[model samples]
Target: MQRIAVLTSGGDSPGMNAAIRAVVRKAIYHGLEVIGIKRGYSGFIEADMWPMDLSSVGDIIHRGGTILRTARSEEFKTSEGRKKAYLNVQRFGIQGLVVVGGDGSFRGAEIFNSEYNLPVIGVPGTIDNDITGTEYTIGFETATNTVLDAINKIRDTATSHERTFILEVMGRESGCIALMAGLAGGAESILIPELRYSIDEVCEKLIRGYKRGKLHSIIIVAEGAGRGLDIGKQISEKTGLETKVTILGHLQRGGSPTAFDRNLASRMGSKAVEALMEGYRKHMVGIVADKIVISPLDAAFKGKRTIDLEIYNLANILSI
Candidate 1:
C-alpha cells in the first residue's frame, strides 16, 4: 500500500488524537503516504482529505476527542453513498484505510471491505468499552476516571447533608461505565441495562442502610437502566431519603486523555498500520491480556460485548 487514509467515525472518544498521531507517524515511518479523512465516511464520500505528515500530528497525543474530527454519517449507510466513497478512495490512490470508532463504524468498514475490496482496519475508540474481542476500548479509562471525579465531589456533599446522591453516567445499552465507576466510587448500588434491577429492591437496600445508621450513600445508574430523574424520584419516594440527581452528560467525553488511554491509542494506532503492512484487512485491532491482537472487523456487530459477569457479581458483593 503506497498511500493510506484514516478517519474517525461515530462519537469521538478520548485518546483518538493519540491514535491519529500514531497512525500518521507510524505510516510515515514505514514510507507510506498518510491522508487524514475528516468526518469519517462522509469525508470519504466528499473527498474531505489532506496529506498528513509528522508535523501534522505533533504534540496531539495528550489531547481528547479527534483532531481529524468525527461524525455519524447517515448517508454512508446506503449503497450509493458507499460508491461515492469508493470513487474518492480510487482518486486519492488510497490502498489501505484505517477507521477509528465503535461497532457502528466497524460495520461500515466491514461492508466496505466486502463490497469494494478495500483494505481496512478498525480501531475501537468508544468509552462504552462494550465492543467484543478487547477488554478495554480507547476512552473507557478516561471516562471512568471522569465519572470517579464527579462521584468523589458529590460524595463530599452527600456526606455533609446526609443525603443520597444518584449519578447518571452515559451508557445507552451497556453498563460498563456505571459498573466500573460505581465500584471505584464506592457506590452503594450500581444499576445497568445488562441486569434486571428493581427499584423496590434498591429502596429496600437504602431502607436497610438507613436502619443501619448509614446516613449518606451514592448510586451510579447507567442511563439505559433508567433516567437519573426517574430513578432519583422513585428512590426518594420509596425510601423517603433526600436524593439528588446529577447527570454527567457529555462531560465524561471531554478533557485530556489519560495516560492509559494515550498509551493504548498509540499502541493500537501503530499496530493498525502494521496490520495493513502485513496484508491484514477487514480486521480490527484489539488488546487482550495487555497484548495486541487482531479480530474480524465486524465481530462487534454480531453482538454487543457481554459484560464480565464475574466483575459485576463481585461489585455486587463488595457493595454489600
Candidate 2:
C-alpha cells in the first residue's frame, strides 16, 4: 500500500508517541503517506484525520502518552459503526491502518479489517503487557521501572516503621508485571492472579518473621490477583501486624518512555510499515526473543497466554 493511517486506542501508554513517530517517519522514508487518526476509532467515525509529516512528530521520541490522543468508542465495535469508519477511510484514500494499543484495540482493528478489507497492523503499546502473542509490549519496561521506583520508596518507609506493606501493581488479567516487579523489587510475598494463596500460610510466614524480629515485609500484589486492601485487612485482623497499602494506579503510565521502549518502538514501527509494503496485513508486529515477527490477528484474539509457572514458583523460594 502507498499510504496508511495510524491511531492510538484505549488508555495511552508511555511510548505511544514514539511508535507514532516511527510509523510516520518510516512510512515517509519508504515514500508512503502516513495519516495520524485522532482520538482512536472516533477519529475515523468523525473523520478527524491529518497528514503526519516529519515535522508533525518532531522531538516526540522521549515523550510519554500519544501525540494523536486516544479514546474508547463502542460504535467502532458495531457493524454500522465500522461501515462509517471505512467510509471515512475511503474518503481519505487510506489503504491500510496501524493500530497502537492493547487487546481491545486489536480486536477493533480485526473487525475493521474483516468488514472493510482494509489492511491492519497492531503494535502492542499497553502498560498492562497482558496482551498475548507479544513477549514485550511497548510500555512494559517503563512501567516496570516506575513500579520499582515506588517499590523502593515503599521499602524505605516499610523498613523505617517495621511494618508490612502491600504494594499493588496494575495488570488486568496477566501476572507478568507483578511477577517481574516482585522479583526485582525483592518483595517478601508476591501474589498474582495466576496463583491462589492460603491466608493461613501467609499469616504463618509473617508470624514466623515477626518471631524472628524481621523488620518490614514487602508484599507485591497484582491488581487482578485480589484486592490489596482486602488482603491487608485480613492480615491486620489475623496477624495483628501494622500494614500499609500503596496502589500505583495510572501514576505508572505517565512517565517519559525509557531508552529501551523508545528503541523498541522505533524498530517495531519501522517493521510495521515494511510489513504493509510487503503485503503482510491483519497481523501484529511483536518482539519474541529479540526478533520481530508477525502473528495473525485472529490467533492473537483467540489465545490468552499466562505467566510461566516456573517463575511463579521462584517467588516462593525467594520469599522464604
Please report the candidate that would top TM-score against the real structure: 1
Best by lDDT: 1
Q: Write the per-residue lDDT of candidate 2 for residues 109-214, one digit (tens) a residue.
A: 9987877789999999888887777889999999988998888999888989999999888988777788888888888888888878887888889888879888
True-structure RMSD, every candidate: 0.9, 1.0
- Taking all chains together, each candidate's TM-score versus the true structure is 0.98, 0.98
lDDT of 1 by residue, 1-320 (tens): 78999999989899999999999999999899999999888988999999999899988988888889899888999999999999998899999999999999999999999999999999999998989988889999999999999999999999899999999999678999999998888899999999998899888888888888987889999998889999999999988899999999999998899999999999999999999999998899999999999998878778677777898888878877
Query: How far is 183's C-alpha from truth in model 2 (Å)?
Result: 0.2
- Model 1 regions more than 4 Å off: none
* Clashes in predicted model 1: 0
Worst 10 residues of 1 by lDDT: 298-307
